[model samples]
Target: MQETLFCLRVGHRLPYSMSYSNTTDFTNPSTFILLGIPGLEAAHVWLSIPFCTMYVAAVLGNFTILFIVKREPRLHAPMYYFICMLAITDLVLSTSMLPKMLSIFWFNSREIDFSACLTQMYFIHCFSVMESGILVAMAFDRYIAICDPLKHSTTLANPMVAKIGLAVVLRSAMLILPYPLLTRQWPYCKSNIIPDTHCMHIAVVKLACADTRISSYYGLFVLFCVKGLDMFFVALSYTQILRAIFRLPTKDARLKTFGTCSSHLFSILAFFIPALFSSLTYRFGQNVPLHFRVLIGNVNLLVPPMLNPITYGVRTKQIRDRLHQLFSHKDI
Candidate 1:
C-alpha cells in the first residue's frame, strides 16, 4: 500500500511513471491535469481573450444559422439542409473543447475526470469526422446543382440529404468508437498532465505504459483513410464543377455560377488547411514549439465553426436577404 501511494505521488511529477508489470492492472487515472499550453502557462490568461471570442462567435453564428434555417420556410432545401448539418457538427466540435479550454485558461480548473476526458476526446474527433463528411456532401450537392441542373432536385432531394446526414453521423461515430475503447484498455502509468487544452486520442494514448503502436497506427489510418477519402471526393467533385462552370459560354454566366460555390470552397479551406497543418505538426513537428502546435490544434476547431456561418450568411443570397429582413426591424 505504501509503495502504491509512493508510485501515485511520483506519477504526478514524472512523465513516465512506474513500469507496468504483468500482474498489475493500471488502466484509468483519477483525473488528468491539462496544462493548457506547456512552456506558455504565464500567457494563458491573455490567450483566453481570443479563445473566448472565437467560442462566443462560434456559438452565436452557428445558432443563428440553425435559427435562420429552421424559421425560414423558403430556405428549406437540400443545400440549406446540408448547411444546417454542418452547423450542428461545428457547434459540437467547438463546444467539446473551447469551454473547458476557457476554464483552464481563466479559472485554472484543469483537472478532467478520466471518463469526461474520454467523452471530450470522442466528441471532438467524431464531430470533426462528421464535418469533413458533410463538406464532401456539400461538394456533391454543388456538383449535382451545377453539373446536372435538370436532375438536381430529383437526384438530391431533401430525403436523400437527410439520409446522407444520417450516414455521416453513423460513420463518424463508428470510426471514433474504437478510439475511446482502445484508450481505455491502455495502462496510463505516465504523468497525468496533458500539455494541451483538451484530450486528444494521440495525446492520451501516448501516456500509456504499454505499447501503443496499435493506437498510433489506427489513428493514422482513420486520418488518412476517412478524411483523405473525403478530401479526394471533394477535389474530384470540384474538378467536375469547375469544368462545368467554364463550359458556360458567357463570362458573366460562368462568374455567377462559380460565385455560388465560393462560400463552400472557403469553408473547405478553413477546415482542412488548419486540420492538416495541426495534424502534421503533431505527428512530425518534433522541432516545433509545443504551444504553437496546441494553438494550431485549437484553431482547427475554432476558426471553422466561427467562419462557416459568416461565410454562408454573406454568400448565400437567400440567407443574406433573410438576415437583413429579420434584423433590419423589417418583417422577415
Candidate 2:
C-alpha cells in the first residue's frame, strides 16, 4: 500500500474523540503524529545512541546467525533451520519498527501516513506472533530429541521442518491480517499522537474516534491466540522434558542434558520475560511511567534479536568455531 496520500486536514485535536458520523463516508487521516516517547522527547538524542547500538548489534548478530547457518552445510539440520527462521523473524521485526523509531527520535520525523502506519503494525504484530510459534517449534524439537531420540530425525526431517516453518508463517499472517484492517476502518478525528515510538496495534487502535470495545477485544483475542497459546505449549513441552531428564540413570547424563538445553532456556527467558512483563505493565501498571513503559518496550523488541546470536555463539560449538574461522581469515 502506498503511503503517499493527499490529506485534507480538519478539526481541532481531541485526545479521545468519540463522535462517528451515522452516515458512511470513510476517509482516513493523511498522516499520524507519533510522539516518540512522551516525557523523554528532550533526551531523544541520548536515546538514539543506545538505540543505534542495539540496532547495529541486532543486525550484525542476526546476520552472523544467517551466514553461519547458510555457510556450513553441516549446520543445515532442523535445529539450525529453526534458529535461522528465528533470526529472520527477529531481523524483520526489529527492522520494521526501529528505523522509523530512530528517525523519530533523531530527526523528529514522526508523520507516518495511515497506510504506512498500518503496514508497520501488521508486520510488527505478525512477526511477533510468528516468533512465538518458532519458539514453540523449537521446544517441540527439543522435546522429541530428548524424550524420543530414536524418532527425532525421521519425525522432523527436512521436508517436515520446511512444512512446519511454512505453516507457522501462514498461520500468523492469516490471523493477524485482520488487525490492520480493523484499525484502518476506524475514524481518527482526534489527536493522532501515539505515546510511544512506533505504531503498535493498540497504540494505533486507541486513536479511533469510536467505542473501541470490539477492536480492543479482538486485539486481546489475537494476543491470547498468539503469545498466550505458544507459551502454554512451550511450558507444557518443558514440563515433559524435565520429567524425562530426571529419569536419566546417570548424574552426568542429566547434567549433559541440562547443558544441551541451557542455551535455549536462556534464549526463551531473554525473549519472553521482558516481553511479557512489558505488555503486562502497559496493560495493568497504571502507575508505571510512560517513559519506563517505552523503555521496556524497546528492550523487549531489541534485546532478543541482539541476544539470540550471542546465545548461539556461546553455546553452539559449530557457530563459535565458524565465527573464529571467519574472524581469523579477516585478520589475515
In model 2, the runs with Cα more than 4 Å from the true position are: 1-27, 330-332
If scored against the real structure, what TM-score would every candidate get? Answer: 0.93, 0.90
Write down the lDDT that model 1 would get.
0.88
Q: Identify the leading candidate in terms of lDDT.
A: 1
Identify the runs in model 1 with alpha carbons over 4 angstroms from their true place.
Answer: 1-25
> Candidate 2, residues 156-262: lDDT per residue as tens digits?
99999999999999999998998888887888755465677888888777667888778888877876767888889999999999999999999999989977777
Q: Give the TM-score of candidate 2.
A: 0.90
CA error at residue 142 for candidate 2, angstroms: 0.5
For residues 32-93, could you state the per-residue lDDT of candidate 1 as single tens digits?
77878776777889998998899899899989999999999998999999999999999999
Candidate whose TM-score is highest: 1
